[model samples]
Target: MPLYKTITPNSQTTVKIWKITESYQDLMAKVNLKPVALERVLGMKSELHQRGFLSVRHLLQEFGYTDSDLFYDENGKPHLKDGKHISITHSFNFSAVIVSDLIVGIDIEKQRDKIAVIANKFIDYEFDYLNKMEGDYVKKLTVIWCVKESLYKLFATPGLSFKQHCLVIPFTLLDAETVAWIDYEDKKHRYNIHFFEFEGFTCAYALV
Candidate 1:
């Protein structure tokens, strides 16, 4: 069994997630791939890839879907024949997924000191606001990374720069929640974002 927990925001639409940390056998069986593309990826990176697939599979089962029920669009986004939206993530030992009627994105990261080194890469837009944070720079940094990563998935575009295109509202590190946005020209698409850090892991969600 996958050792995991789940959360569901109070939404009119059916939106939910299955967070897991266990063997991915049952979840993998659901997709029932026939030695095709995604199925073949399983062998290349068993531990990493299996966890992700299992998370999505667990989600499909909740809605009476088998592994074969899931499909990918031309942009490599996962889609369901039932018209439900899905996003998935997997770290070394944990996996998560968010599914809803509208677009959704989920991300999980193992907390590490290395983030400080790459901070400049994603911290440009945030520097203006983060510099004002008196003490908890680490916590603030973690949230910003999560927020930008979630937006990357939400946009389904990896090439977008976090500092240039993604923006997180100014909030103290200790706050459990914050709002963020992605800008395309003058039009700003907003997202509802929330994050939590526990067991040396940081998890976040973005729904638009």
Candidate 2:
């Protein structure tokens, strides 16, 4: 059980992160999945994705839930049977879950220079403050990506465009937290964003 870290952003919200260091077979043996989930995992072509899927079940156990207690909406957002808000993400060697009484979202992404190549796809106004020449440019981009990804998960709207609608307020790596907005359909909404890096990966969550 490589439960790497846990965070309580608020009294009602909890974040659990897992550092995936287990073999697919090892992780599979530790979690009991529903029939549909079992079939889904067996059908995955990538062993890494299978392990990531299993690790999330482990995180749900930490939250006192089981595979049967989770389900997905029409839009593919995860939900808890008990009506608590839930969001999940996995990347490379890391996976995370955020459960809260309030709506919330979480994402973990491996920081890679390649992300800069596609920055224009998901980035818009933030470019005004991002300096490609800066030494932490990749790190900053990763954070913005993670933040926007979290927002997307929470919003769970079909037409929400990250480039055109989501905006991450400027912040330095040291700040570790910032604000983000979803400007869609002529209405603006705000969220509190918290993020941090570990083992070459970044984890971020949004709360409203």
Candidate 3:
């Protein structure tokens, strides 16, 4: 069975995360699903995460949805039935879903050793609070990536660069509280980005 958590941003917005411990095949079996139904779902993987999204969508269907109920626009943004807002992401054995009356996004990440090698690529001001010497520093890297990724999903733009456009305020994984912003045209948009690390993975979600 996958571990699941839900975050309620307000009265109308709810974000949910699904974490997996078994292989894709095992997860599919849990829901009595067919893997062949996952054609577009395979695109989410940049490395090993490719098939992860399929599992997430399949799990969603198990709850009360069909694959066709989810659609993507010409700009590659996802839309729910009749155009309700939706954002989705999966990394390794974890996946997340965000549905709101307004714009929303979510991301999940596995703590990996290579995160330190490419910190500058996606994190800006967040580095101020990041010290590689800290305990479980790799977990912190996952948190930062999740924050930036959520911002990217919310921005929903082809050219919105994470490092340049999204900024996460200084925070710690132990603190479990962090802030983030997207300053476009001097109109700063802020979000209360939340982080949680459990069972070797980190998940983040926000509404701005």
Q: Which is the leading candidate under TM-score?
A: 2
lDDT of 3 by residue, 107-190 (tens): 888788998889888877777877878886788888888888888887777877788888888876668868888877667889
lDDT score at residue 113, model 1, on the 0-100 scale: 64
Which ten-residue region of model 2 has the weakest summed lDDT?
A: 1-10
Go through the candidates in order and give the clash count of each: 2, 0, 2
Residue range 1-208, candidate 2, lDDT tens digits: 5799999989999999998899998999988899999999999999999989999999999999999999999999999999999999999878999999999988999999999999999998999999999999999999999999999999999999999999999999999999999999999999999999999999889999
Return the candidate ranking by lDDT, descending: 2, 3, 1
lDDT for model 1, please.
Answer: 0.71
Better of 2 and 3 by TM-score: 2
Q: For candidate 3, report its TM-score.
A: 0.80
Best by lDDT: 2
**Residue-by-residue lDDT tens digits, candidate 1, 30-145:** 55554564556567656667676667566656656776767777667777778888776767666666777878877888777677778988877678776534556666787788
**TM-score for each of the candidates:** 0.82, 0.99, 0.80
What lDDT score belongs to each candidate, Candidate 1 first?
Answer: 0.71, 0.95, 0.73
Model 3: how far is 171 from its true place, Å? 1.7
Model 2 misplaced stretches (Cα beyond 4 Å): none
lDDT of 2 at 153: 98
